[model samples]
Target chain A: NAGVTQTPKFRVLKTGQSMTLLCAQDMNHEYMYWYRQDPGMGLRLIHYSVGEGTTAKGEVPDGYNVSRLKKQNFLLGLESAAPSQTSVYFCATRQGGAKNIQYFGAGTRLSVL
Target chain B: QQQVKQSPQSLIVQKGGIPIINCAYENTAFDYFPWYQQFPGKGPALLIAIRPDVSEKKEGRFTISFNKSAKQFSLHIMDSQPGDSATYFCAAENSGGGADGLTFGKGTHLIIQP
Candidate 1:
């Protein structure tokens, strides 16, 4: 089964351009998160959704927006991309229970010039 | 402010050697700590994890040593091999607040030399 899948494996955008990253999970998890990984910066949370139709801000949610309109899909949107937004973005999901393990997707590499 | 701090931005070790990565957190509410391994062009995967109540937990060649008093924890890879080279991350979550998300460290890039 495909655990977590992220679309647009790679992308390049000019400054002020807009784009959307999609994350899909087949594990029927209740929580989904968006994070960006940078050199020496690890992975910082961008936004998250607890369940369908619910979203919340994360550590680095300034330049991004997210929607969880469906149970299996979470979308992260970049209204106006910036150079600083260039990084490898990851999508993760976790089953709601006592176990706190998070499953991640391959990742999406975005470069904003 | 960074809630979790990881040391040694990069490390290199010979084959069959032991490579250790350390992480410390400031939040006492954090009860769950986990380590993730990531290969090039892949997402980070859970390596091993530990709770504050346990002093150590071992799985295969991976081990997690937790020191609750010091708010510190570490990952020790025994018999390291070239295939083990990857970026490792330490993360913490406050389960008390519900599993909202995790606070991740800056990450440790490890290279195992053959």
Candidate 2:
């Protein structure tokens, strides 16, 4: 079982460029989240989806947008990338129930110059 | 504002030593606290967790000590080895708040020397 998988393991973008990061989960989890990890900043939530077709803003949702078009996939998009947006991004999923354990994907390293 | 604060941004210890990472939170509504371990180029994985009602919980060589009154929690790794060197993060969540998600600490970089 491939718990959580993120695509585009590494990317480099020029300022104002746009890109999308993909997160897929085979565990059939109902909750998915997008987070960015910066040096000495830990992981900050960018956006999240409680279930398919439902999304919400997280701690650092300003420069990103997310969509849960399907139960197995969550997409994070940056309309216009910036230098400050250069960070390692992670995708995580949790089962829908009382348990709070969140499974994470390897990660996507994005650098905006 | 940062809800969860972690101390000792970096640490080094000799093999077989004990390494403790501490975290404190300001949110009283947080009922769950968990520690995550991340290796280089990997996502953070849950190491251990504790609830506010419990003072301590242990799993293998990893332990979580929680103090409800002080809103503080810590992770203690016994018999630390070189393989145990990695970044550790502390996170808190309020189950009462629907889908709010977890607030994570800045993380602690630990190096266990051989």
Evaluated on the second chain alone, the candidates' TM-scores are 0.97, 0.98
Model 2, docking class: medium
Evaluated against the true structure, the overall lDDT of model 2 is 0.94
For model 1 chain A, where is the 10-residue window of minimal lDDT?
A1-10
Q: Write the residue-wise lDDT of candidate 1 on A1-113 in tens digits.
A: 15899999999999999999999999999999999999988899898888999999988899899999998999999999999999999999998877699999999999999
List the lowest-lDDT window of 10 residues for candidate 2 chain B: B93-102
Error of 1 at A87 (Å): 0.7
Clashing pairs in 1: none
Model 2, span B3-114: residue lDDT tens = 9999889999999999999999999999989999999999999999899988999999999999899989999999999999999999999987878578999999999999
State the lDDT at B9 in candidate 1.
Answer: 91
List model 2 lDDT by residue over A25-56, tens digit each.
Answer: 99999999999999999999999999999999
TM-score of 1: 0.98
Give the residue spans of candidate 1 off by over 4 A.
none
